[model samples]
Target chain A: MCAAASSPPAANPDRKSNAGATPDPWEACARLEYGGDRSPAWSVREELLATPPEGWPAAETRLLKSLARADATAAGRAFLCQMLALVGSAQSVPALAALLKDVDAVESARYALEAIPGAEASAALREGIAAVSGSAKAGMIGSIAIRGDTSARYLLAGIKGNPSEPAIVREAAGRALEHLATAKA
Target chain B: MPTASTVTRRRFLQQSGVATAVAAAPLILPSGLRGAGAPSRKITVGIVGAGNISDSHFGPLLGDPENVRILAVCDVDRERRDDAAARVNRTYGNQDCKAYGDFRELNRRSDIDTVFVCTPDHWHALVAIDAMRNGKDVYVEKPLTLTIQEGRALVATARKYHRVAQHGTQHRSMKRFHDVAEFVRNQGLGRLDRIECFIPPNNRHVGATWKPEPVPAGLDWDMWLGPAPWRPYTSLGCHYNFRFISDSAYGQVTNWGAHYLDIGQWALDMDASGPVEVEGRGEFPSSGLFTNATKVDFTVRYANGVPMFCRTRFEGGGTVRFVGERGWLDIARNRMSASHNDLLREMQAPGKKIQLPLSNNHHENFFACVRSRQRPIADVELGHRTTTVCNLGQIAMVLGRKLRWDPAKEEFVGDAMANRLRGRAMRSPWALI
Candidate 1:
């Protein structure tokens, strides 16, 4: 059977209580399965991409609200993040910034923030350097380096010098610094 | 299609310091001293990703002109790497081949002069770039990279290091492909109008959804994922099956497309550049372990007004046909057909022809270039450009729209979303730069 055909509805039970308002487009995302039927979510993404500049706030708001729902599944939120990476603006930064500290959500957050563009996203990644450690911290450092945010050089240098940081994280910071230096060259 | 600048073989060797001793010699070396059996002439190699593709490389490297050495084999799977190491040692009648779970360890070895990056698509750029940066020539498997951005990075790295890099488009080494490419280049078929590339359907059998399975013994699942985003282990997603998954591979589009599209690019003489406009649509597995497109129909229009159409179907024996105003020439593995037999006949005359460099064996060609410091037949720049064609088709398929591409800038024209798709953020601690 088609994987999308067998998927269950979005797990948020409260989402259906609003009968009169425009149907929540993302209600089906919470139960979206990877490597399975994603047409339902893809359709919503197409809608989001087609949104005009003036309507981006509404679309971003809806996705953020769905992402914050207590019952929203991790897979569902990741899907939302994929959409936000495309149409999202500065308004979506804070919600995504919070995800930088989430072990489960940080990867998804990085996926979005890395593509969102602009200074806000770069700042969130810079600040995120302190909020996580180990692999999470190492990953955020990699993202910052890819952005070529020269402002993070001092921050990365400090991490490279600190003895308390794990060797992997320290090595990652050192490598990231080298990458930024090469970019400047 | 940012083509490589014309660097003559003699100039390349001079710049690379390969012929410095000869240039400084009072006279040419005595004939006896110029023997080909010198141990100093050996090209030491390390094979990364000892998976299925490694089989094709081993046969040539192990039984060669007696100068190529397999010093090490690396794979995330312990069993595979150990088996490859054992095979190499057995062939050499010694226990010298090292096995490693991390390619970085292999890349760091100064003794290794070249690396065979046979890893899955996602790991290609990271492994190959690291090898080049460490002064090792590389033979990266076809498709070149998982993303367009990775291919560009690889080309830049090779030029920066002056490393002799070859892409694993072995068809170019075969006489048949070389003949057809030369014929088309010489306009044997008349005015080139269109090129059609027929790809076979996705052959792997996979269900709509996949469930996580136990990490098997001797397999480092995390290492296998490498730069790709983290995911649970599943037998269906590892080994050869990785090609069917979206994260690790781009299905048959890259798996088969890379081979056929490579020939098309060579025939069209567009190795340094590519189509300015592209559009396509494809059918992806709606919900299954196989997320790559199952049905692909895409077209890219070159600046010369010729359009190359790539489509998936069971017919055509999965061939690439160069169509011209007068006739067409079709080519595939051990398969060839032409509108007129006279064209093929005339190509055999071979005098005053736009002949491409010939290498009956791909591995031997790479080793030759490693010592000679000349670009291989399928250099990294050509590999990147061919891969760019595949990646552009994929991006167009996913976006379901036409995209205007700037080959020089290597970006989509005025399309931020499309440009963003050129590359993805490497899963942390694995930056390509």
Candidate 2:
């Protein structure tokens, strides 16, 4: 559909005759688009997409990849979430929110939740709390308390330092609990 | 009807006669027309806009020795103005050239014979009118005026003041563009049916939000805004970002659309006329920084059965494509391609002529007319007509309705609501006259 609308002008001998008379080649090119069959639309899009991946900023590349797979499967969504987290795009919060309940992508969702900044990130954290289980939920609550506003105090109070948890997760929860306690005082 | 050979011979003879007469009479006419010997003195030229387009105009004007001398420069920002002036002075070795923070101060100088009004759309008319009133000719950037009424006034004022005003629609100066237009019109390219103009999208506005900030020091924010309604400063409201808003500028339609569409109109030989009807659909920002249409497809129909299609996001930057009964031609700034290699070869061949009273210099075209007392290549009427198409597209987007325009009367046909949009209410102390 996009290609047809942007198809280059139909080739004609007369247009060439006219353009050939032009003294400057650049001006001829400017006129050829209106007078020729070449679709500038297709060329512009092709050029943009052809730009090297390394040439694009990390955030732009992540956004492009996410948009490319926005309608893909749960695993695809998980991969996108992981990529978004790595780039630290606040733009990833909405994507993470949409994926929070997809059971296969819960761990990726947790990473996205941790990566989002400020209030929106805390909301994603709250949503992740109900969908994930055990240590993941505890970790999300600790992340929420650290990143969220005053409204997150109640979530902070629910974090219990279980011995079975990884040492780093336990330490993060302990620190969040201490911070929440200090805030209350 | 006269045969093609007879018409061509007659035109050549007429032009030759005029050229010979002009050479013989070396007198300056009252309407500020200069004959061949009017004066070889170089006129000093000043540049008003020191933004992205400074290089485009600066290089061409500085390179042409017959027309002008690099004199002074001005920008709202002192640093840019100084830098532009320094560059010109260094290149031309004219050490006494001055830099101005205010265009009004630059206009006060008697030594400056012409002013390049390359500022933003909002400032084009204001500076051009002021420059003319100050007895200086003007070469304004394209889309000539910000509003329909302003365009009309600029054209009228230029004539009334005997000032030579050239809108910077430089494609008119290109031989190839004239050939394309002539070929299409002459039936060498078959029947002209459809013309499409494209402006590609850039990422400057993607996921962007607008927040007002204090006007920075070393900038006159109000003057920069000019005739645009008073508003708090935002990064998006000035410089390269100004086109994204309706209040400050007309977005891409007039930004790049003006140039491409000007070429389209020129090719169609509609320099003194425009579409009778115009309509469009596009996505405008619902909130945050941008208010201009992000994506749009607009169609304008001329009285002569020609349709102009202008679209955004078909590619990037801007391009114009013409579709004729026999074939088509595609043109952008840097490239030209045709389906038939023969056509490209033929277009490049010599002896196939399209003449435009050739002047390799835009500023020279204006100065020659300043002396000749004749219209420049991109004359006011031509500028108004081309700019009207752009303004019509903008109005269609703003009103979100199909508008019927009377090219002869230069007004909306029985549509009072649309007609009202033909001009804007100028802010006080900045009168249109």
Candidate 3:
């Protein structure tokens, strides 16, 4: 039986203190176990979002680094990706796209990338489709279609026609292409 | 010479062809009786989602056995689908009804003419869109899609397939709601000032932490979570309780507000369009598995400057109250009230009666439209527009700021953060489009 999944949980007991004024706690929150207390992290998130537009770069820097931590839980990464989806820019795309390689983290990675509007976001999805396989690849195809990345038209066509690709992936590619065509029409 | 404030009954009737009289005669007779096709030809139906809501649809549909045939029932839960199919079989005194673990199998049956999508919000778009693509008309429950993008896709698919898509925002079919909408549309309220919709909060609650249990014997947990983010099964997170969770549903805002807010759009005569600005505050369970708003206070302003205020009130069921310069009228299930006792009587001094599309029975309306090939009382586009209002308020609550919206483009103005919340990426192998 799989363990129950709930909202993201709390602060990390093993978090190492950084030397600075108002040290960033996002890393600590990102290290918390699945279903741990996330209130402290949510407070920090609120504070970060409440900050003016100029304060986003620093917050994005902290969040992106936390997302890259090998020790961070997949649950934590998913939560961070959600925050980044709201506040992230093109700079956050590569890290997000990289996380698409992690099986557990792939959904959240594509979720964040799907929302961040830019040619780069779609490009990351197109690249992620080639890098990942199975459901992850199919999901990335969906993200590209949602982003309306016409540039991926050839890529999708190739996957859809490839007999080697899994049926699910090929069907997803076909559906994405159909959806994009309908969108164009 | 009547100004905007002084809305004459004749002028109102001229501008909008909706009825303003107080009589309930229009609802007493089912519209299906008049327009329903030949009794010999039955409209075969396959209902997806055999939980509590399925009973509401199947019961009435089964009652019209001569005109409607229950061919199949589908659900991810084995017990529920089997029970629903058994019930249908029992009603017919035969073993003809088939139980399906997956809706796709049922949708593939070329004989089934229409589908009733009573699935959860997250599954609404995927199921309905698939059914339409397979050449089936659909009657989908309220808060049509989980996201604006999904709603757009569903509408496009419906148009492409030429399916008779009826939204289950049944208030549009009820007599009291119709009267209220007609009253407002005919300016019986005298230059509409604002609309107020009161909705209830989440009916169920969950604790801060939960341990996932083993998947139940008869339930397919993965299939149930279709298109939603993968999560381990908690006994409390499945079935009816899915409404409380953010991943699976949008809580009371979409649950109850979808019905009430829909009436506001109808009364405002903005069925094809939506609000231009929205802002709100919400109270969510900060730590619980349930992530949707428990209480929400949001106001959506139309381009015409009529603001529809939706608030969560713990009592009095739910109502859509339209306030105007002259008076106010509030309508709920089986009842309606106005600022003055004689308001209905005064409005009865009608020149030419303004009659809106009349639908007394929502399910029957769907079946009638299935045969007539006309747009139902609650069309998919109207559902999308209403659901858009609910989602905009929800997004505004989440962002905690006022945002500009372009109803035509169906996107937030210069706000990527808000736009991000408009649609979520569906989980793999279940492409939303």
Candidate 4:
């Protein structure tokens, strides 16, 4: 039974050093699995992160994994994306950018992208555009149009002949092209 | 514009005062009953399972001050128990109401006269039996029990206790539902040949890939699992999403199907009996999460040449379309449309014979039965029969084969393995006894 899975022992000073070194957040998340009246395990993690220990980066990455593992809401995912970006580890970039293509996390991913360094972030945005279809594509194009990026307009122009393209996508593409031409003028 | 009759002019003013006084009496007086200075009587009602559907019942039960007073609310979830208690206090202006995280504690309360078994399907039989044993009348929610054995045990317990048990099929009390059921049975729509019951698709996902989250505060996860084998806390199993799983619920078959199938049984006058032959086909997701069928079309044939068909997402939720030799009747909540208006008019005629009991109030009907010690219009047996039809449909879909059912014996005829599936082994400390 999933509920019967044994919870890890309470935090002991001796165990703290080993727990701090573990990179996966899911290991800590597994300890918090009982449902019903038990208080959330994330609250404890938040308290730990409030004043991070000496080995902060590994703990932060582990905490991000725990948040992602416990992703029940958009807000939680957004919080995880933000935390990963704050840690600024190159290893966290793929996990944060992965949120760019997740329908639930797209908007938060855009915010996290602003904090991401250079071409990797741009490449992630392009990949996110390619990954989305239907109404989601239009939303992506609208965001790109708002940023007023010429590269986004160029990519949006190439996404033709796909029937799945939403009306909003076509509208946003036209608006992006107009914004680009006007910027040139 | 106006010449008043001579007799009316003086008499009207005198009559108006008495009428005003009579109308005001119920409002102004602490107790509403007229003439006698008898103290107001309060019916003690206890609620089990303070989950989402509890609010649906609470609105009506607490709203009707004339008939009911919520005495106690119980839930495994401490948070929900407190929330329901607060709502009850706010609704009735009483602060002394009790709350219990264990239903057994609520059942043991001598103050509670009637028990509302609103818990998950698995807990229904145990709590209801305990309440009955404690000499409390019961108002159980639909799809009466989780399994056939549990249904049988519940009915047996009700009989042993000689308690009034009312299934939560509120439509039985509605005027329109009565008219539709009477129309089909009385041959107003001619000889009923086929009936179709529809339930909408459930898109909620389940399983390992659907990760478990941190358990919310003020919840008792261990108690929530109750008799079911323990599983890690997932929102999917706790709230409205519980319907998507097999462990806690029977999926849509018992949830939405219970509502529609009750109407079908009522229309067919098969409250005591059900279809003998059951068969069906369905589509399940190939992978990732959901286990219950996405779409299913099932048929059950009664001995008297009537066949009832159930389709998931064929149209929408809780819909019943009765096709007769002449015309068909389609009815859902608050909407009853027919192929022929004349048939509907005939059903509405004065002195028309309908088997439905005259009780406009669902809660009141249960309360009345509690006092009078009579069977409600929808009794335990009727609920079991209707739920059996639903269970049969699910069995057919799961087995992908035809079934022969004996409603008299309440067993699948000639299939030992299928017969065994009718009941489940309860986890320890949650015995049906």
**DockQ for all models, in order?**
0.23, 0.01, 0.24, 0.01
Best by TM-score: 3
Off by over 4 Å in 2: A1-185, B1-39, B64-67, B314-316, B345-359
| lDDT score for residue B151 of model 1 | 93
lDDT tens digits, residue span A1-185, model 4: 00111442122222122122234333443333233111123333333433322454675567556556743445445444444444334455576567766766665555455344455665665678776666556545544543445676567776643455666566556655654554432
Clashes of 3: 10
Candidate 3, DockQ to 2 decimals? 0.24
> In terms of docking quality, how is candidate 3 classified?
acceptable
Which tens-of-lDDT digit does each residue in B1-433 have in candidate 4?
1112333423322332233223211111121211111223456789999987777889988876765678899987787899999999987787977889888798888777889999888788878988987878899998898888778878877886677788888887677786788777777777787888888776455222455677788778877776564456777567766666656776778888888888889888788889888876655443233446667667888888788888877454568888887888899986888888887778777665554444454665566455445576668888888888888887766555567899898989865435645765343235443
Model 1 regions lying over 4 Å from their true place: A1-25, A33-39, A46-57, B1-39, B203-207
Estimate the TM-score of every prediction: 0.87, 0.63, 0.88, 0.63
Q: After TM-score superposition, what is the CA distance of residue B305 in candidate 4 from its true location, in Å? A: 1.8
Q: lDDT for each of the candidates?
A: 0.78, 0.63, 0.78, 0.65
What are the per-model C-alpha RMSD values against the true structure?
Answer: 8.1, 21.7, 8.9, 25.9
Point out the higher-scoring one by lDDT: 1 or 4. Answer: 1
Model 4 ranges off by over 4 Å: A1-185, B1-40, B206-208
lDDT by residue for model 3 over B9-68, one digit each (tens)? 234322211222112112212224223234347889999999887878988889877678
